[model samples]
Target: MKKSLVAALAVFSLVNAEQISIGGTSFERVDALKAYEVGCASNDADACFEAGWIHYQRQNLNKAIELYTRACNANNYKACTNLGALYFSGEGVKVDIKKAKELFSKACELGDGDGCNNTAFLYEQKKDIKTALKLYKKACDLGHQIACGAYKELSK
Candidate 1:
């Protein structure tokens, strides 16, 4: 049993190795999804986010959303922001501005400047200038340059 486990791990490691190119030749890329899945299974939120990004890049929106949600639940604010953007844009799922706002708020509370900025934009679109200003200010305080500019503009 131990030998079988060792063999399996060795095979897995080989599969996850970076592809090599020699003398102007190229090799097929490693299976990033499998590697990420292993990482995510170990509770690595960043790996889950990376997997989601790969899926997004491949236009596999549903899979991206699933992975992003998992990372977000693990307190990965960037993943929350990404998932919120998908909800806001109705990409791969029905439009859910309310859900997007909730996710953005969660991410902002977790100290994601971009999430705060996004939430502020949503509030601005809803004609809630007061909330927008507050959120923009929060984002600015978090060192978001664009949010600082918006805060300055709104304060003027």
Candidate 2:
């Protein structure tokens, strides 16, 4: 029993070691940010996207936009979708529906389900029911749960 307790404690410590404590605040796997930063510095688009996601979660919208833009420029579809959302909602930049639409279209072309759904939403707002239904169907087929619900409602 003592041996089992010691082994369990060791495993717990190993797992917890990956987390970071800053000024009495503990954060989950903060070291992942460093790894992402290094990968982004090396021009890895996925890493840039991940770093942007972390900044977004922390409510650092400016930094998130910056990193997401970098990843989007590298043709990261998910990054483009996220950046487009920020622009669409005027989170860190001016609201530019045209730019957001363009980015959403690009991401949809790259097979991103959220992009398809967002593009459908824009079309729905524009009263283009046909295009909205088509895009929503596409998103639904790509396994977007929200899109599936929207598609069902719109189809009905």
Candidate 3:
């Protein structure tokens, strides 16, 4: 993680946005990204996720990674899964399967179906079919559509 991201998070942690608010704030649909950025700067995990997603759409992968790292550190499962996807696919950063597995495992621990499914895929790649099957079952139970199919295929 970059020092800048950590520094921003540390600073945000010291102050609450609402405590410093002077007047009413309106978050228009068109300005949603701006609102998310403000909220993220205030250390809101969901806002960090929204901001990261916006950055990702804009092809600002470094910014997205920083914000996603913040959100993931805050125990936001979606952010963990997305961060793992980035590492797994080598989109903006170098491919690191171990890091991706670790992040996906964290997301799975937080009850994300996508995370469970992804973890299972990695396990399958390593030829650990039993573990993969178990993870696939868990993911399937959690409503990961692809995991359901994978589980059935592996069961045969």
Candidate 4:
């Protein structure tokens, strides 16, 4: 009986431990954000994006990054595009221009017109005007009207 009690207590403690090994902690504040988390975890891209943005607004960049990464990994094009933007701007994580381009390209390949436009903008900033023009044209052809204007502006 004593051995069983000890085993049960050990299991309970393990379950209740605060450390988060995989995705980092779920966060105590995550309770209030449960609805969003549920939807995100259930593969709702918009919910994941919104939750990530909300956390970013609250200055919880790590949480935002975590949520954004999950959504992106789930094949959420918008999330991938947004995460690329974050990487480019050094908003949440360190500035990684190369990584940003990779993410933007991934999002674009997934049919995210916005991602194409964003990638073009990043390339423009890098003085790779030709590639930027090409991506902007692609975005415009993909029905991103704003990209047309941006393309014209940057092409000059």
Per-residue lDDT tens digits for candidate 4, residues 26-145, read: 433334244456666667666677678768878989989888888888788888988998898998789998988888998988888999998888888888999999999999989999
Which lDDT tens digits does candidate 1 get at residues 1-156? 422332233345544345533234332234545556666767778768877887897799999999999999999999999999999999998999999999999999999999999999999898898999999999999999999999889888
Q: Any runs in candidate 1 off by more than 4 Å, and if so which?
A: 1-29
Which ten-residue region of model 3 has the weakest summed lDDT? Answer: 15-24
lDDT of each: 0.82, 0.82, 0.83, 0.75
TM-score of each: 0.80, 0.79, 0.80, 0.69
lDDT of 3 by residue, 45-137 (tens): 887897798789779999999999999999999999999999999999999999999999999989999999999999999999999999999
In candidate 2, what are the lDDT values of residues 1-156, reduced to their tens digit?
422332233334433335544335343445556556666877878878977888898899988999999999988999999999988999989999999999998899889999999999999999999999999999999999999999899888
Q: What's the lDDT for residue 87 in model 1?
A: 94
- lDDT-best of 2 and 3: 3
Q: Which should have the higher TM-score, number 2 or number 4?
A: 2
**In candidate 4, which residue pairs get closer than 3 Å at backbone N, Cα or C atoms, i.e. clash?**
none
Model 4's alpha-carbon lDDT is 0.75
lDDT of 4 at 53: 71
